[model samples]
Target: MKMKRKWTPSTRFMLIILYFEFIKETITVPCPASLHTANDVKRCPRNKLEWNARAARLNCSSINQTCVDPSLFEYHCVLNKEGNQLLEVCAPSKHIHEQKCTEFNSFGKLIQASVINCSDALITCPDAYRSTEMYKYQACYDVVYQSTRNEEAHCSSRSTEGKSHLGIAVGLNGEVKCCSGYKWSNRTRLCEKCTPGYTGPECAYSCIYPYYGEDCFKECDCQINLCDHQLGCTPVYWFNNCPHQPEYEEPAFTNTWKQRRDFR
Candidate 1:
């Protein structure tokens, strides 16, 4: 006996369904030529073309991981995800910055010859000295030094008095010498000229002229009047003139003489 064929709903569905799928593996290409030097890479036109071709072979995510020679046309090399090298030419570095010196000297001025190193900075000494006068010295920052033998001798003379040899000697310890155009006065520490109304050392005392009392406290006694009642009189003009009394008649003497003669 022949068997009867039966069709189910799952069988009909399987017969009607048809689908297709395809997959391809990623590809990586090697760089065409090796650029030995920056100059060689720049001169070759194939360098740029091969660089682009290598970049195209890489994945989109990793297209910037290549190394190029900086000296070669200022270009940058980038790689693709497939590990291919690329070259990108860029412009040279800009000249927007410049360096400058910290100090300058004028014409006809001399600079010193020295090197000073301080902190992180370097300083060069001037080529010539600023002043060539006698007893002058160079002053640079914290350091002070005498420039000549005369200055050194002057300094030694000051040292004997136990004073500094710098710009100016100060305090009570320094003595004023006549050679220095000054006379010492125990009272004032500064140098001064003799005042018109005063004389002697440091002009401490007043000159004897129209002034009379000590330190010229008393003014001249040349007033028009003979005596000054306000300050009493001096020995030279002590007594004032006396006033004369009024004259009277002589009537008593004649009667006395006549009475005496009659008694005799």
Candidate 2:
């Protein structure tokens, strides 16, 4: 018997006509060179011919050749994405020239100048470029010239003495002493001593008393002997020549009268 078949809602269906419409609409649009040429002037005889015919007649060999005569076209020009001429001409390369002027600290010394051209620019060194103070400038067609200055060396002063900080000297004991100035005191490092009348750490002040005169050369004023009588007397001198006077002055008898007769 012919039974009734069930139709499920999940069953898929194909639409060939609709798929073809979507594919055609999604394709990329091609450039219309024919329409582009119509907007240009027809004055040139070369423009009237096809690009391939013009290239063959010109005998162009390079693959990078864009046209029969590149000179006729701007060597440097700006164009839009659709191959339409936006700007007539622009800089071929975006580069500029930079110059540096250098001189030595001394005017007689020689100085060097370095220049670097990164773009289509003209660079030149000034007369002062070789001088102690150099002035360099860079220029372009329409741009202003920029100047740079520097210095070089000519004459300089150098120390002839070595790096040692000590001075040699013969000590009183015949030993070598590292002295700096008048004083032979410093045993380690070189240092200056007190001047004719000065003393102290830096020999800055004048000396007093025994240490008097220039560099404390005067003798001290202190007494030499504690006792009044002495052989070596400095300011004053005295003599005591009583040799037997000590024994005569002995206190043996208290009162000496007629001795009360030896009657005892």
TM-scores of all candidate predictions against the true structure: 0.14, 0.14
Question: Could you tell me the lDDT of residue 23 within candidate 1?
Answer: 13
Model 2 TM-score, 2 decimals: 0.14
Clash pairs, model 1 backbone? 58-81, 58-82, 59-81, 111-126, 111-127, 111-128, 112-126
For model 2, the run of ten residues with the poorest summed lDDT: 147-156
lDDT per residue for candidate 1 within 1-264, as digits (tens), equals: 999988798886665552211110111112112222111111112233433332333222232324323332222221111211112222121111111111111121111112331223243323322111101111222121112222223322233244443222232445434212124444543344443444332344332223333323343343313322222223344433313222445567767877888889
Give the per-residue lDDT digits (tens) of candidate 2, residues 83-171. Answer: 21111121111111133322111121111222322144354533322211111232311121111010001111211132343334434
Error of 2 at 183 (Å): 8.6
Q: Compute the lDDT of residue 191 as modeled in candidate 2.
A: 38
Q: Candidate 1: misplaced stretches above 4 Å?
A: 1-173, 176-199, 202-208, 223-234, 238-264
Off by over 4 Å in 2: 1-160, 163-193, 220-264
What value does the lDDT take at residue 158 in candidate 2? 19
lDDT for position 31 in model 2: 18
